[model samples]
Target: MRPGATRVGIIDYGMGNLYSVAKAVEHLGASAVVSDRAEVLAGTDRIIFPGVGAFGDCMAALEARELTDFVRVAAQTRPFLGICLGMQLLMESSEEHGAHAGLGLLPGRVLAFPPGAMRDRDGRPLKVPHMGWNELHQLVAHPLFAGIPQDAHFYFVHSFYVEPANPELLAAFADYGFPFCAAVAVDNLFALQCHPEKSGEAGLRLLGNFLAWDGGGGPACGI
Candidate 1:
């Protein structure tokens, strides 16, 4: 963390790969600190929530850390990014295991891919975790996609996906079985179902864009 560099707080609720996410922020010339303290997050210029694994487990961890309210408030007050399971935790609930409540920052549900809809072209099973790289189709313009080209490949590793209640909140979609919300952006919050840090050049560009974001919505934030 250099002097005058933007400080980006990466929430460590015992779920995310905080070190990798921290490295990504630092690679972009920003200060990335991994902590679960509300006070630390409050002082950050921006915050990122990156998680791996189950929806229920992630939410439970946040609840244990008493970060449910803190996250919701920080997201609205500054530039916020959610990655993978972190994005799904923004939904109202998850159907992964019975009915589990999330942060409810976004009005939607995290649903598993329908059993019958998990096949790729040529009628082959695409696997439950939809692993590897997939192309992202931009549905709307935002600062996050400024330098990134259209239909760029992003690394993904998830079984569940977000179904945002408001269609306008959708920023991009990708095909695992059919089109699913691969990324979402609205106001000061931005979330990605894919792992941008693992997505190579295009992914780094998106991170750089997020680092430069001024918390004023999209392109106007930087692009």
Candidate 2:
């Protein structure tokens, strides 16, 4: 991390590919530090939560780290970003395995894909895990999509979608079985269901926009 560059704290709560996410942040000219310590967290300008696997496992890991409170603070006090399962965990709860509680940063629940509703072009049952490039239809405007073109295709890999109680928070949506929340934002907090690290240039640009965000949320906190 070079001096004066924006430092992004990539929370390492025992999930997801932190390395690749770090690389993507660095590629956007920001420093990505993976840490769970409250002390290290105070040193960054923004934070990112990237995770994979089950929601129950993620909640357990967060509880073990004793960093849950700090994460909630970061989400409200700074520009926060969540990716994939990380995004799902930002909601109030998830139905992945029985019932699992999330960070409650957003007013919604993560739900499994409606079984019979998931179908292919010819009406065959689509696979459980939706994997591949899908187009995101923009429903709201935000700094996260600053330079990214509308209706851009992003790589997605998930079987769950967020049902936000406040529909105004949804930034984009993609249709599989039905339209599902693909990205969400409320003030400074943001989450993306697509892997910006794998969506090629368009994804990279979204990261770059995040790196360059200079809203009134907070001052540049050093890298």
Candidate 3:
């Protein structure tokens, strides 16, 4: 991949919103290709894992495509980004379906929000899906969020969130019933629990930022 041109591989393991993510990447001036083939990723500068389904189903799809190993290896060296369910899979495991193991790229577990933590300020159930725009407070700075405003609102639609074993990996957070990790980063790995594609301008800015990030300039982790 060229230094200024970003060719992002949108890993298609049959579990993500690859089309929407591809559009987002393209809107950001990057070439997005959807595939699970390692050859497709050979010359790519960035890898995007965009998921929109169950943990077990996603894992099964990746395993069937023989892309799990490739994903692990890529995250180790290249700039990696995961969205929504894809973000959850970056953790060590998930309790969503009987202790299913995750990629373990980050030290954490993907878990559902506690009942007490599912209500709004007025004590109303905030809904399991949590689908809408919410402000993401910058917990730690990363080049991916370079020009994003503080407390920028992003679209979200999920019942579970990642609980990082190491707090230092949390990059951004949001408050619903309480504060929770909405985005995380450890080295070149980044995962966002929200949907940047549907987030309008600020979200587009994020995608652009990711394309431009070299991963060597973010603030120290766990700030």
Candidate 1 residues 45-90, lDDT tens each?
A: 9999999978888888898998988998987889999999989998
lDDT of 1 at 211: 89
* Alpha carbon deviation, residue 50, candidate 3 (Å): 0.7
Q: List the residue pairs that clash in candidate 2.
A: none
- Over 17-81, each residue of candidate 2 has an lDDT whose tens digit, in order, gives 79889998987778888897878987899988898889999899988988788888888888888
* Index of the highest-lDDT prediction: 1
How high is the lDDT of residue 175 in model 3?
A: 88
Off by over 4 Å in 3: 1-4, 219-223
lDDT for model 2, on a 0 to 1 scale?
A: 0.85
Per-candidate clashes, comma-separated:
0, 0, 1
- Cα lDDT of model 3 by residue, 1-223, tens digit: 2346678989998778888889888877788888888888767888888999998889888889888888888876777888999899878899996889988778899888888778787878877767899999988768888788899899999988899998888889998798889998877778899999889998899888878767666544531
Q: Whole-model lDDT for model 3 versus the true structure?
A: 0.84
Return whichever of 1 and 3 wins on lDDT. 1
- Name the TM-score of candidate 1: 0.96
Candidate 2 positional error at 100, Å: 1.1
Model 2 lDDT at residue 190:
77
Candidate 1 wrong stretches, greater than 4 Å: 219-223
